[model samples]
Target: MLDFFSSNPIIALAVILAVGLAIGQIRFLGISLGAAAVLFVALGLATANPAIQIPPFVYQLGLAMFVYVIGLSAGPVFFKEFASRGWKLTLFIIALLISLVALAWVIIKALGLDSMIGAGMFAGSLSSTPGMAAIVQIVNGQDPSMVGEPVIGYSLAYPGAVLGTILVAAIGAQILKVDHLKDASEEGLITAPLVWKGVQLSPEITGKVGDLPRLSGQSIIATRIVDDPHSHRLADPQLPITPGMQLLINGTEEAVDKAIAALGEERETKIEDTELIYTRLTVSNPEVAGRTVGDLKTVEHGFMIARIRQGDTEVVPDRNTVINLSDRIRVVVAPGRVAEVRKFLGDSEKSLADVNLLPFAIGLSLGLLLGAIPIPLPGGTTMSLGFGGGPIVVGLILGALKRTGPITWQLPFHANRTISTLGLALFLAGVGTSAGAGFRGALTDPSSLIYMGTGFGITLISALVCAVFCMAVLKLKWDESMGVAAGVTTNPAIISYLNGQTGTDLPNRGYATVYPTAMVGKIIAAQLLFLLL
Candidate 1:
């Protein structure tokens, strides 16, 4: 077994990933380590046999693939968020991370530990494998022989980082006394869309369309209007309402109920034989990409976009809601305009699976170039974004751009996710195998336990402090605060646990809002910690 692994790097990596994933699926105390299992498994294999060596390119390739794809997937929201309320949340997270780095520095000085070891512990305690990679690069650039110390420190502190963050989030939930269900509902975390409601336009609903009471935090789209027994016209916000007229509306279930209460009693309106057709059309037209729903030439094409589905999330689109590539739009069109609508959308299922190789190649190549470029620092030294940070930063920029001229940057959602997952698995496998020998050496060292204990303390303190600040200072909700804490650590296990606990997507929203900035910040900070020391 040892000889086989030693001779074939690919086979060794495969074994690590397969076994790690299997171990990750096992729940202990209702929490599974998830993908982090790969790293521990790799460490075990490496320790068992020192000859099981892998090439450096394997790990670098995995890191680049993982971060680059993650950036692409998160780019749209990350950029959009800066213009909205997300900037404030991002700033707070940055501050928290800075504080954590300072705390690590103080601990390193007090303990009289080597700078490389300190940097590794900092990254490991956050469970940020990418950050650890950055530190390793810096250490190797300065002195190749010193590389082993950081990797050893990283392995020592990793388990604590994962468990510490999970414990903080779980404990924070209890301390905050969060009523998960109530908070989720109040925050509109439940995605309830595609509810068709029919109502009678009562006498009290006087005046024009502009006179209706506004349903705060709800988007209600009127689909059809029944003027009489035999005739009906497409509902428009501008169209005046009359007493005893039947109307069909589309929105969330709660919004529909509110609309019915505000308008009149519930009424049955059948549209089975109507010429107006309701259908789901995939957005494939390059011309419509990046344009808002209201901006689409739907009126000219004899169709009205009632709703749009982006990935699995259904959206009640507004005038400003942008149309993205492959969006499944629920359009209401006339019978004669079906062909025109289909032509405009380019709704081809085969096209969805077919990735535009040009843009994909261009994006990845550009990312590699950006990653290779170096920047000067104040201390007469230099640091690059490295393979980890460079690819992700470039991916974010391209992702936000969505499309430039003929090149559409967006990949199919499922395809993008698959690539990202594969990249991460390969990355962890590489890191684990690369650090295996060092991790084994550190395991027998008496002081290694002290280093790990200190790292755990740093992780716990930083997470607790940040969580409190998010709740008390930022006035964020409990789940949102916990999610931000989890994101700060960059641990997928914590994110999964929070999602299960809340039974809502509130934690996910919080996680996403802070992840990009936190990810980039930690990567850069880890290197800086190593260099400054």
Candidate 2:
């Protein structure tokens, strides 16, 4: 059994992932990905496997796959957010990254630790394995053996970071108590009660349109027609009758009867007012599929398109764009005309469960391949091509160019979740196996462990301080506050947990906003600290 465990690293990884999944599903002590790595190390140590090894190339492959998946998920919404919200969130994320680097730098200088070790300390403190790997690649080239210590150092502090983030998130939610449903009820934000009001036609307006005294000069009470407090008036008394016009003689029913006697016209049956109508429709027809806003106008009643919500992202339709099946459309139109629009567009009901997973897998695989191609950076440095910050950049470019896949292929929630989980598991497994072997060697010198500990201490202090600032000063919600800490860690799992607590589908956005800056800062800090020390 021991020999089997020793011989099969892939099987070992699969067991770890399965354990993680089970723990996640059962809510057993909130075991994080970082904690899983720590557990793997403990297991390896207990077994006394001195020759424990994981191929360096596996690390590269895992990193590429991980980054590629992340990039594909973040690409579409990141730019859309930038265009809408402007620079506030972007600036905040950038500031946090700078703060983390500066804090790491100061701690390194004070401790007199090796610069590379400092970098490792920074990465571990953030719980960011990819950042550490990136720095190692930059400083020590693609040789994994040369940069092994820093990666090990990073692995040491990751578990604590994950736990710390979870604790913070739960506490924040308890404190904030953000209940949108309660607030909406208290504020009377909806008009369902007003929708039940009945309409009556004035007796002055008979069945015959011409017999009705010219309403052209009168200020007609059209409140139910448009929901506007102000009423509209006919410009000409000679104007002919429309299908659904209401005429009134006086404010009361008796006055209306006297007016009908004077006008010699009979009252027609009352129709439901247009302003009380609300239409809900789903897109089922193939005509709108893969078309953008520009293409939608050609369909009759398509002009009634008010808003288009695709997954978590919602946007106003434009003329050049195409619509996809299952996209929800909200429009304001006359009560009688709504059926016409509905009939023209077809059924719009879409089940969230029907989202296609194929495109996501294809995009993710392609992204991974693209990320694995190593590219040279400035100076004498060349980083491995696999995912991390570079793949996200490449994916964004590809997404914009429509080179990677179809532009209309919107990412589904389940596919994103699956890819992210698998990628992270592989990534953490690589980090754990690599670190488990090297940790023993690195700890041989007590001074090295002391230096690493000090660096981790600095990271913890910096992260906590920033977290406090985000909460106390910036007044960010618990999820957002935890997101800041997770940003420092550069681990998607931490972000995912926080988003889960918030019950939102925007874990990808939180990751994307903080990832690039964290990656760069961590890499620079790790390398500069190693070089300087």
- Per-residue CA lDDT of model 2 for 150-229, tens digit only, reads 76666556555666656666665677685533433343322121111112334444443323323422211121222122
Error of 1 at 277 (Å): 3.6
lDDT of 2 at 432: 58
Backbone clashes (count) for model 2: 23
Model 1 lDDT per residue over 230-327, tens place: 45566655557677768777788888888888788787777777768788888766677767666664666777777888887887777678787788
TM-scores for the candidates? 0.90, 0.62
Which residue pairs collide in model 1, if any?
none
Looking at model 2, residue 58 earns an lDDT score of 61
Q: What is the lDDT of residue 247 in candidate 1?
A: 75
